[model samples]
Target: MDVKNKVVIVTGAGSGIGKAIAIHFAKHGAKVVVSDINLESAQKVVDEIVTNFGEALPIKANVAVFKEVENLVQHTVANFGKLDVIVNNAGIGPHLLRTHESTLRDWDRVISVNQTGVFYCMKVALQQFLEQGYGNIVNIASLAGLKASPNNISYSASKFAVVGMTKSAAMEYATKNIRINAVCPGYTESALLTQLINAKPEMDAILKSVIPMKRYGKAEEIADAVVWLASENTKFITGQTITLDGGTSL
Candidate 1:
């Protein structure tokens, strides 16, 4: 639970919140497995961690593919001997579009990656956790999971499913020493949000005004919350979604 020298796996760790989480955990003396769909990106992070004297292994894995997820777990345990924590952070947000204009293709794509992908990772990790009799999982959901957002129907739906799945799994393993939880980030300062802000400069002011904090969250800030949830600091915490939205949901 201390996570010091614990074997941890973080998906989508090539960039953004996932990357920060991986780095943070490594900095705290945890052996991290950095996984992503993009091998190059994951390798970059892994290299940085190594340079900083942290332990890490970069693996190319697309969480949407079940076999790849299984491989991810298999390889981690093979290398580290056991897995203590897993962060299901790989996800895609659908392009902003009204439901009337959104296609079934769009729905499938979002659901497959955001929803089904989480399931695959959880299922595989859960098996290992059960065998070890202890494990922790932190899923990166979204504010959309807690509140409906127009023009993001697909994304919202998928995240809502993640929240539900987290709770259900937590209950199933509560007595088994497996803790499952989610982190819902709202309008964080990440590559995705930066692209949107750059495209519509005016929307920047609007985004800031909506949040009570009058600013976007830093990736490291969300990383802090995640690390805490994954650490022994919150052993009693489980089946909960910690929202890091700068008080936007409030």
Candidate 2:
């Protein structure tokens, strides 16, 4: 009952960590808005939530588009009556390639979604939050945002920007009852990771060797952190990046 009756919006919620986060909030009595680029996938999550007797709404939206993000917020407020939490969970990882080999298009694509998209969502959500006088934003950044990531130039750069944006925006709204924070997940168990491991079978061992815990973090684990951040229990916490890497960054 931590978030009971709260209206939550989760982007890229069709699958992976986004999906898990949406479900977690619903279970805790939140009215979730499942937004994703894939309409079918978003509807599936909505169907599941509805089947479970939880309130949910599905919307197909690409966060990269500011107009689309605006509509997303408007739609959520129309359906749910208000917006309490906005989880900027929609993001993409660029292909693993050395900086020199990566093209301008590659960098642009990653930045458009991972970096600029977050800004669009945050800006629109902040507008709504300011009017309401209260809001919570939990951006899903990566551990790579904290450190250098070889062969992932664009992704690293974009995520680093996300981290900086989170901190700066958090400070701007810190005293306004609007809390903005981020979660830096290391190697997490998800469909994307599965594809990565499948492409390079040796990555399995490499990950275990690098991560001190010898395991990847679960989607649900990250979801737990996100839900906690969205709750009022951490009212004193803001502008913080919770790293859930299991000592990998160390």
Candidate 3:
């Protein structure tokens, strides 16, 4: 699992799971690119890394936009001299609503950031990987992707697309030494989860009761899995979705 000296990029690294991933990668000696739409937030993460004597660079990017995604990859390579791995951790959750109640505006926003954003990141990263002959990608999906997520049509749809895209891209680049994989987390303790719980207070108990573990996952736990997937130890693993839920899908 040694990732020392590798140049890695983590999108939406300003907070939550992305923040943990960026910090964890840096702790393992990877040169991290902390990317987020909010430049201030991204810089804060970078500051934390620098304070701990870890290497990091802050770059603001909106994954939904192609030009920004392109610049993110370009800027990372320009600063680091090479790109080794990219973690597509940027995503947005939609309001909990059934398909009939969902608005086109909400659906588009979710798809743009959660689905198309992953595509843009992967496309740009794959281009760089092809030139370098080897690279790794880890996408942060959701448990709703594999199982039915009632009342959250947009989020579920976008995450399912991520899972499919991860496998498809992995197969396409398998022989090229490019590895692609995704992690589907369930009811993690993040701002997104908090928002959901706040929207429907009953969801707090409802979610935990379904999980065999009777608890929510931590951001660091997800980060650890991501680091392992991106490391050499999992070099043979690709096109797989690792569910990090506490037996909720079971």
Candidate 4:
């Protein structure tokens, strides 16, 4: 869609790829809703967008919580007066641990936020879309969804579910004017990646080893893909997963 005047919601917009996508949408004239668990971080993004003269709203929400997700949509509609697009980008990758070594807490937290969170957001967003008869959704998945990268079972499983859910929703709404798609990224250079790198410097070499590009992806690169998916350019496209893996998944 011509994002020139669209209302878009970007969860996890406080940092990394989420922030980049929100900024791109705003730069292109969309009224963006920057929702994140960090109020200060979300506000900072809103402040930057406003500085650029783009309209945006900063909201603090934990997408994993049903109530918070509900309030998020309610508030967005109230402020923007309508809904057009939603980027289910909030996710958590589990730290390195063998399958037998992973804890229940680790599994629950990752699955709840990364998997169930997408469902909650999509559920509420679809309700609005059905009422309005139009909508777009982009779920950020990962290369792990397509292949076993070892470790990160919870994250990988959640992402795999996202891809399936995107396809199922797209088919279910094929004629209903609601589009759902996913973006599967390889290891991207962002705050999350940085943290992982700092925790284990050897991981840097290991991550690059799997990538044919021999380099990490930038947040802006992934953002570009998301904006295109959200735009009219992909109007006929749904139930698809676009991989920006720099050949890592290949």
Candidate 5:
């Protein structure tokens, strides 16, 4: 788990799981780039890191846009002198509708941010890694990617693409010193889950009942896995999807 002095970027790092990942990497002595669509939120995380005597920089970038994603990577390298890791953590949750009930707009929006955004970040980061000779990438997928998600077609489709992309890219670059991996978290405690639970309180019990642990995963727990995937400890592991579902997937 040695990430000391490594230049890392975590997208959607303004809040929730992405925020936790950024903070965790900073705490581990990594020079973190807190990239989020919300500049204010990203800066707040950076300020908190600075207060904690950790190095972090805030950058406003919408991952849905390739240009913005490219700029995000460029800025990180310019500021930190090298890029070591990029966490593709920015994503939108499902619309909670069946395939037929889901709107085309929802599908497009989710695909743009959740699927295409990961591609953009990975593409740019891969280019940088080729130049530098080594790098790591950790994508934040979801349990839906590994198994069917009822009433969540678009989200599942997007995350599945992330899993596929992670493996494909990992194999393609394995010999080039670039490692790619993904984390699939299920019902993690975050603003996204809170919002879902608030919208349908009954789902709270239903979700907990299905899980063997009978509890939701914490954001920090997901962050821990993400950081480990990006650390030197897992240098030999790549193209794998690490599921953190508390046995829910079972």
Candidate 6:
């Protein structure tokens, strides 16, 4: 809600959407906890936030790991003395293969990071919320979650799972003052998208053509949606998936 002194943890704060979300939340008066697998990268975002007079803490955590996720929440609560919001944005969509061509390892990695990782992050956050009687969770899904991306089966499935998880969690906690929602982003010019575009030009064009807006969505635009959803602006909202997908799902 009112984020002035609220403590917020954002996973995958190393770069791209996560970095943008972390920066925006900090700029908007939230005390942000910047976490990523890479400590240096997380620190960079934290540095910028603090340099600009916002408060932040850089913590290296692998959200896919339960213990790490638990400690992450524990440390954030310890540092800020209260928990208000958690953005489970740490995910990987590296599977660029057809279903039959995909390996179990690829599927496992994508599912673990994109789907199960969100579960772990929220589990810890939910525990604290149950104890304190309030909390908000915003998950980063993908446009692929709402539609099929034939080649990237694992990625799409992972995101779809996130969407389902978001809804279920939201409904379960709605009466308990906990809100859970998801933001589904379309193709953005992140390193992951750039790599995919470079590898398959025609496929990239096909992907863009699906978006009625005819262009890639900006990371900042998605960040704006996330901050608003996490802010006091949408306190009554829960069990919702905010699509920042440039009309791709339509």
Best by lDDT: 3
Taken over the whole model, the C-alpha lDDT of each candidate is 0.93, 0.94, 0.96, 0.92, 0.95, 0.90
Compared with the true structure, what per-residue lDDT tens digits does model 5 show for residues 1-250? 7999999999999999999999999999999999999999999999999999999999999999999999999999899899999999999876788899999999999999999999999999999999999999999999999999888899999999999999999999999999999999998999879878988899999999999999999999999999999998998999999999999999
Between prediction 2 and prediction 5, the one with superior lDDT is 5
Per-prediction TM-score: 0.97, 0.98, 0.99, 0.98, 0.99, 0.97
- Candidate 4, poorest ten consecutive residues by summed lDDT: 146-155
Name the runs in model 5 displaced over 4 angstroms: none
Report the Cα lDDT for residue 205, model 2.
97
Alpha-carbon shift of residue 93 in model 4 (angstroms): 2.0
C-alpha RMSD of each candidate structure in angstroms:
1.1, 0.9, 0.6, 1.0, 0.7, 1.2
Q: Which stretches of candidate 2 lie over 4 Å from their true place?
A: none
Which segments of candidate 6 are over 4 A away from where they belong?
A: none
Tell me the tens digit of each residue's lDDT in model 6 across 1-250: 3567778999999999999999999888999999999999999999999999999999999988999999999999888888999999998876577889999999999888998899999899999999999999999998889977888988899899999999999989999989999999888868779878788878677877877999999989989999989888898899999888777777
Q: Please, what are the lDDT tens digits per residue for candidate 1 over residues 9-124? A: 99999999899999999999999999999999999999999999999999999999999999999999999999999999998877778899998999999999999999999999
Better of 2 and 6 by TM-score: 2
Candidate 6 or 4, higher lDDT: 4
Total residue pair clashes for candidate 5: 0
Clashing pairs in 2: none
How well does candidate 2 score on lDDT at residue 133?
97
lDDT (Cα, tens digit) per residue for candidate 2, span 146-234:
99889889999999999999999999999899999999999999876887788789999998899999999999999999999999789
Across residues 90-116, which tens digit of lDDT does each residue of candidate 3 receive?
999898888999999999999999999
Clashing pairs in 6: none
Residue 155 of model 4, lDDT score: 79
